[model samples]
Target: MKQLKSFIKKEFFHIFRDPRTMLILFGIPVVQLLVFGTVIKSEIKDVHIAIYDQSKDETTKEITNKLLSSGYFILDENLNNLDGIDAIFRKGKVREVIVFENNFGQTLGKEGTAKMQLIADASDPNIAKLAISYTTAIVNDYIRKLYPEMQLPMQITPEVRMYFNEEMKSAYMFVPGVMALILMLISAMMTSISITREKELGTMEILLVSPLRPVQIIVGKVLPYLLLSIANAFIIVLIGHFVFSVPVNGSFILLMLETILFILMALCLGILISTAAKNQMTAMFISMIGLMLPTILLSGFIFPIENMPVVLQYFSHIMPARYFITIVRTIMLKGTGIFFIWKETAVLIAMTLFFIAVSVRKFKIRLE
Candidate 1:
């Protein structure tokens, strides 16, 4: 009995003496709660779109003003002719466009009917659908103001046209999604567990206190996993190609480059997790429960983010997998290059830098 009590006291002392371990044990749950609380929200704000006003009338102008004022979309371009529409889409800068029919207000007043077009660049079907829904809601409010609690006898038809995936294949949606899932699992989850294993076995302290710089150690630990993740990405593409008959319509080089970028993002996230985790079990739990589920569920992989509760949709924005999935789908199905995916790529880059910076700061704080 005396020996057992002494052993338990020694164990408690060892755990409490290390501030890093104490911080990891107590700090992680709070961070996760704050992150989940702050990030999740179901709404789109300030999406970029364009307008083609053929009518250029008071009513059309008023509707346009209302759309802009609703704060869902920002006007990217205004077209006087149809010639610029294709160019605007090619630039991949705009998500949607509203085109009003000729003499829109005059026709609406005289005949109680009018026509407008909602042309959405359906490269991202989810976003396109959401933007259109918001537009429809705005148009409905306008109708209520004009007709006074009755449907307009003459319709103001909103003709919606989808640019990509007219057939809307499940493959077009799930293949990219699966790729994002696999890469995140392999890169972030596995690397985090590996790093935490060193801490469990007491080698992490040795590595940290050794000759190698902390940044170099982190990079070294993550590099092999980075390469492995890249290979796994290509393997997924090949499987998606040969097994599922998924086509690689875009440039392979661009696809691989994007894959590498996503892998780096995941690796940085892994390093961040390692800094926050005291052992392999905790790392695995954080990676699996904290990160993997979000990658699969909140990244728009299975459920359309547009359909999720508003808070969940907002939470999805912070999932690195969400942007990677969008990039993969745009490249594979839409056959677009950097011009189309640069925005998503830039987002991943920004996240990678953020994670790396945070990891470095945490390491410095611990050492100090």
Candidate 2:
């Protein structure tokens, strides 16, 4: 017990004594959260829209006023003719153009309907869809108020309920992703590099010559990092909660347990990586190229898996971060319990065991 405590203390001292390690463990999580929350915005606000109101009547004017007042849109410039529509879109600042037909008010008054054209730049398909949806909703509301007495036999209005992210904040999506990313990177990369550094310095043989058993040595090395990684996980969640208004709808204790599980998984994978790599540079290269890219791209961190090709979707299934992200979003955003995330939890556990087994085999062979 005393020796293990001394080993854990030595590992912590090693980490604290290194300035780079301290920065990575203590500084990076807060920095990444601020960047994702403040800089990488998800929701559309104050989208610039252009109008070509050929009608120039009270109805069109009222509708325009309603759109601008809705706070989703800003009038970039009004068009005199449709010819300049192309030029406006070419500028790229204006996202959409609304063109109302001539005699819009008169037609609506007599026939209860007037046509309008919505031309949007499809360069950014998501923004274009959102802008169109916002404009259409405002127009429909105006029409309802204008012709309340014009009753039809049937009416169907679709009520959309945005679950998890009520405000559609990008931070809600990115925070979990960033947490997964940071935890994986710091644990796997740092551990592998640390182990490889021992090998490079020829200190690994000295440790093996000491009284500590091989398993004890490995455990001691991992203990400090495991605790540190857990602390980092809590720090990320705290910043995400208080700073970005992200909610943790599920049991907080369950969240912490899952985070610890993931950190262990990452640490085990790091051990396996250390056995494979001959030096610090090689370990770092493998960790960055192998783990970092997959975590960001294939984990559904930035893109939707369903939208990916069939082969890529199958490939993403192998990514541990993919399951972790889903689990986190479900727990934090949906407040789902373990029953809801049992499948993901099972997968993470399976992956952790697989990594630990493989690393143990490799470490034993290296010792022999």
Candidate 3:
């Protein structure tokens, strides 16, 4: 019995000694809990919206104030005309626009009904639906409370228009997100694992000692994967288009260019991961845990980033997938050109250069 007890204590010590083991046992669960708790929210918060109140009447003013005071939405701009509606949405400035028809208050008072249009960017169907629903509810509630004792019940009729995706297909949302995930995992994880395999087999030293420079070695390792990943991306886009009925409304060449940039960035990130990893398993683990979770949770893929906590929302800016998904959704859904997506493209380019620079510096250290 004493020998068995001693063996159990020894096993406990062994488990505690391995940091990876302890992390898997405790750290991961805590992180998952916090991420799931904070990120997975159904309600919208601080959603940016525009308003075109042609009436500028007391009733319209009250309704606008109610929307802003509700804490779910923030006024991004007040549109003077309908021309700016498409421009704002294409620029990705606002999610929804509230357009109150001319003479709204007078019409409501005289005819007991007024027309209001709720135009939402439906590239992300869930958010658009939720925003419209919330807006409609607020308007209806206001009508009931404001005119409860009136002879005729006054109603504000909201005509909802979901831009980009009029039918609100779920595939329009998921295809872009899945594309980002697949490219990130395949490019980053595979590159890291392949490079780590060389170290495991003792071939890395031979290559390092050879006449090949660090930049050359990195490029050689990344090029094959880059080509293959581009092919993979093309296939994913094609399948999304044909099978899922997702559209490519923007410049196809620009979309492909952006896709390649993302793949290259992912490859550089994998090289960075490989620098620290000792073996294929370590590389795979880091890629899955480090890249996958952030892409899924913090990238605004499944959940809206605006709905997350302020800290999490801040952290999300660093997520590469977030930018890529935005670019993809904008090009494919909104049909915007490089002028609209230049910011996201520049961010990916900067990330690629940063990863390559770090990886090269690390390689030089190894060489020395």
Candidate 4:
């Protein structure tokens, strides 16, 4: 007990004594939270829209007024022809083009029907969907008000209540994701680099020549990072709860256990990288480029996997962080238990085992 306590104390000193390390350990979570919360928003606001109103009638004017008043869209251009619609979108400001048929009001009065084409840029599917939905709502509302006596053949009103996230704030989605990412960054990447640093500095040889077993040395080095990552995870969750008013609807204990599982997976990945790399620089490079980029881009962190290209979607299936993020979101936001995320949890366990096996093999080869 005394020896373990002494080792823990020494570990704390090593972490706190280095200002750079201390800053990275403490500062990364806060920075990531702020960046994700404020800067990275999924919701579309004031999306530029072009109107090609050939009718120039009272109905068209009223519809335009309603659309402009909705606040979700901004009328950027009054396009005179179909040729100009493509040019406006190509300029990159307009995301949607609303085209009113030439005889819109006359058709509505005579035929009791009018057609308006809604052209949306589908490059960003989420934003495109939102723009279409908002525009449809605006037009439908106008139609309801204008022709109260008219009844459509099919009338369906969707009452969408987003559970766990009433506001559907992007911050709620990113908070858990950022937590996983930062913990991985600190625990796995930093630990791998730090261990490789000792090896590069020739201190690993001295420690190997000592009575300390390789496993003991590895454990001692990783233990501090593990504890620090747990602390950072707690801090991020607390900040998300207090500062952003993000709720933890599920069991806090379960959330913590799942977070630890993910942290262990990341640490194991770091060990694998460290074993494959010859020096600290190579380890750091592998961690940043190989691990971090995939986590951010391919793990469905910032983009939904359902909408990704088929090849990229397939690529994301193998990323450990993808499962970890899914588990965190399910547990924290959806208030689900082991049953809901068991498959993802199983996947994480499998990845951890795979990484551990590969790392152990590489470490043995190095020893030989």
| Candidate with maximal TM-score | 2
- CA deviation > 4 Å runs, candidate 3: 1-152
What C-alpha lDDT do the candidate models reach, one value each? 0.77, 0.91, 0.84, 0.85
**In model 4, where do residues sit more than 4 Å from their true spots?**
1-10, 17-20, 38-40, 50-58, 77-91, 97-110, 117-129, 154-168, 242-245, 303-317, 350-368
Query: Per-residue alpha-carbon lDDT of model 1 for 137-216, expressed as tens digits?
Result: 89878967976745646857576665566544455566687677667766787668767877789877776676656766
Q: Model 3, range 151-211, lDDT digits (tens) per residue?
A: 4537454687989988666667777887888788878987787789878999889878767
Give the Cα-based TM-score of candidate 1 against the true structure. 0.56
Clashes of 1: 7
lDDT of 3 at 172: 78
Instruction: Please write out the lDDT profile of model 4 over residues 299-324, one tens digit for every residue.
Output: 88888999999999999999888998
Native-to-model Cα distance after best TM-score fit, residue 73 in candidate 3, in Å:
32
| Each model's backbone clash number | 7, 0, 0, 0
List the candidate numbers ranked by TM-score, top first. 2, 4, 3, 1
The residue-by-residue lDDT of candidate 2 on 1-368, one tens digit each, is: 88888988888888999999899888887898788778676667899999999999999999999999999999999999989999999999999999999999999889877899999999999889989988999999889888888765597767878877877889899989999999999899889988899999998998888887778877988888898899899889999989888999999999998988898999999999999999999999999999999898999999999999999999999999998999899999999899999999999999999999999889989988
Model 2: worst 10 consecutive residues (lDDT sum)? 35-44
Ranking by lDDT: 2, 4, 3, 1
The root-mean-square deviation over C-alpha atoms between each candidate and the true structure, in angstroms, is 17.1, 2.0, 15.9, 3.6
- Stretches of candidate 1 off by over 4 Å are 1-168
